[model samples]
Target: MSSVNLMAREVAAKIVFYGPGLSGKTTTLRKVYETVRPAHRGEMMSIATEGDRTLFFDFLPVKVERVGDCSVRLALYTVPGQVFYNATRKLVLQGADGVVFVADSQAEAMDANRESLANLEENLLENGIRLDRFPLVMQWNKRDLDNVLSVEELRRELNPRGVPDFESAATSGRGVMDTLKTITRLVIKDLRAKRIVPPPRPAPPPPGSAPAGLEAQLAQHLHHRQPPATTPPASTGSTAAAISATPVPRTLTAPAPPRVEPAAVPVVSANTGSKVLGPTSALAPGDLFDHARAAEAAFIAGDYTTCVTACTDAVRRAMAFAGEGSLAQQAFLLHVDGSDLLRLQGLSTLPQLRVDDAAFALYVLMQVFVRLNAVGLPTAG
Candidate 1:
């Protein structure tokens, strides 16, 4: 998938441009690429394919006004406009905050235009991205051409939903900024409407713990108790040669310790369960991945205890990682973010979460391990 970043107060909205090849999908992108001042735009990226044709995608991070107490940004992207690159297109649309459909306005290209539009919907459906909910815009490009269809004809044949449409001669840069602004406005408007982004969440008073704080304690416990390394058996010589040569016996030896090694402390934060900082967050992308891998491993091994504990830990750490009004913090609201994850993980038996961590606080973690059927656990035998 492609990533685009736009900044407005604190929100980051990902907008994707979808359309047919040569329909100005790339041209619209090029226009945005050419129009936004260098300081305001991120580098443009295109994946080159056969015949010098390329798949277009871009990311721009720009901060707009502060909403409430924080600032937001958005990422803009364009799917490869080629028909055969549907796989890449579908992948790009995942997690898209909004979309802009760029259509060819020439009269003869109407069929290609229709097929491409239908493809967009189908691609969206295959990925479980709701076409209706995300902000959608339509642009009929190359309008400067002599044979271009009228806006009313374009509306009747395509864009029946009346999404905000633009007429553009991308080469000359007309309607480019307006289109960008329109999409940005729509993305923000949708986030506010869905209430996905939240207001700032304040941190709790700092705990007066030692250097071997909760996190340090956890790493010490896990690493210190790790099982001893095992050695592989030494390979014997050829059987016939061994028999004739009086069978030299050998003892297996453990592999040598690495010369330069990373500290053995655990990557999982005792404070932060999963880092709330998105791609640009405090924790590295690899660290977030490590947390996910660890949690999945624990869950798959029927170690729900560890999974529950880790989830709780993730919540706590997210507190510091997700800034005030960040989606990382605000979206943790039960029914929105954490609820579905917990239910999917078979932790629904747990009660409501404490605000301290993702759902890691004292109240939720305890119920995750407790079973309703285990009455009088000691007397069960």
Candidate 2:
């Protein structure tokens, strides 16, 4: 089953890569793990025979993106492809959100592929998901092998349902990312089609009290702060009716100024080894603090991308000025509700982020910045 953690605003789904033994399921998974940024993926684990044949399963956890304000994490597993491991495969297939049936393209392996496909259908049925309706993708692997069947021939035997399929040489990293991306898209789309329920929100916080911990500090810092008058106007991005500064679990509110781009703010991440944007000019810690305020304002006005970008700049600047492992960074990471410099490092690995996702990321990051600079920070208009 897909797990939705309301308090954390996180959604986790399971995806299984299934195939006959030596069909390249594990190889495909290894390719994906190698390609995904380290910060975005958990350690890979495999239980296999001494000969390297999978005896149980291979597991990798990947953080993909946000869906309707929930962070999506995928637990990718590859069942042992040998027929004797059918029980293990059936157990792993339980609650799967999607499947990638990797078929070895070698002509001689056609019987193995057909048997595995039939086994997959049986297991899926036992798990209460109709094979015909489940989110599935086929990977015609080992395409580079000289003794391989054509894609059409493989499709005729292994992919009669005409599920989306990919041709690949998993060992060489050929089409691996594309195959994974397609399956992810299909799983997300299927979840949406099934109308997976969003996690229930927490009750509203009391008036004038910050949402505990770092939020309290943030509210204190921005309590007397307000936006500047000369700020350029914005398109009125996704605005909430009111700003909630109370002690709620996930409060998102800030006073937005008219949207204008801030100076180039450069931020370097220690965790992910990525640079955050900021101003070129050497600014004091106080000056960078003001940028954090501006970021909050942008988030309030629904300029999430800018808000997140500015918040990154602010954190980086603060860290640089205060030095790494400073009180500021520690305080923010300890108390803030959403993303921090370290956590955002992994999210930055996401490719081609959408606007809402950017906004959500920024909104959370702003919270972190606010908490970090709550004590005696510079004020922004």
Candidate 3:
């Protein structure tokens, strides 16, 4: 089952990799972990036998994109493939939002693949999830091996429902990311359809005849501490009627000034030992100042939970302001102290909020504010 934490603005979904023994489920998962940025992924934990075969399951936590303002965290797991470990597989499959069936491509492993597929279906049924209706992705792994089954034969034998399937050589990382991406999309789509994750809010209307730009409107709302005003529909009546209407649009002859792009701030990743630009690196310092002030005020008021939540919202709003061209679009991991932003978000959802935790979150947010300030806002064009 997927869980949504409104306070943290996060949605978490579990995805399990299930396949026959030595079918490359663990290998596929490792490839995915390696491919993702270190800041976006947590440590991968594996419980395996002496022979390196998965005994229990491998767990990897990955933070992906946002559904609306909520970040989507995926818990990727791989079950032991041996028939004797069916109980372990069933346990891991419980509460799974999606599954990746990694079928061995060798012709000799057809029986193992079929049995594993049956076992998976049975386990999912036990957990109240119908395999046919559930989000699933099929991976014909080990394509580099000799005497491998063709994709067509594998599909006919294993994937009768014709779900999204991919051919892959997991060891060399061929098609592994493709399989993972498809399953993610399918799971998120399913979550949206079930209303477990809210659909993205519609984009606000652009500034029209109003003199104030969108940023100004945001600044005003943040500073004035008032509810955001809704954009009223255009009037189709006489000028007198339009003037008499409530919240009428202001007519301006001059065009809105062009925005100035701020200097990029380089963030060093401790895990990867790489320097990548932060997502809001190009935004003016003042762009996020209002949010920082709000967070600080919350902390001063001794509202620890609200302080943490405000910090999370500050980061989210910064990413949203960065637009689609920013590095955040590629990975949601805001590179402040290597996922401190995400950790701060998790802290906001704690049942017993601590003052120390809230203070640390505000400190991290201020660090971000300082970095942006150091670069200084460029002159408006």
- Higher-scoring candidate on TM-score, 1 or 3: 3
Model 3 stretches with alpha carbons more than 4 Å out: 202-381
The residue pairs in collision within model 2 are 211-247, 227-381, 228-381, 264-278, 264-279, 265-277, 265-278, 265-279, 266-278, 267-276
Comparing candidate 2 with candidate 3, which one achieves the higher lDDT? 3
Residue-level lDDT of model 3, residues 185-247, one tens digit each, is 999999989989865434433546322454345334433432223455456677655555545
Candidate 1 lDDT over residue span 210-297, tens digit each? 2233434443444443333333434575765445554222111122222211122223333445423222112223333444344433
User: How close to the true structure is residue 176 of candidate 1, measured as C-alpha lDDT?
Assistant: 70
Would you list the rank order by TM-score, best first? 3, 2, 1
Worst 10 residues of 3 by lDDT: 257-266
CA error at residue 64 for candidate 3, angstroms: 1.8
**Model 1 misses residue 151 by how many Å?**
0.6
Best model per lDDT: 3
- Evaluated with TM-score, which candidate comes out highest? 3
Instruction: Give the TM-score (vs. native) of candidate 3.
Output: 0.60
Q: Write one digit per residue (lDDT tens) for candidate 2, span 181-208.
A: 8988888888777767474334435554
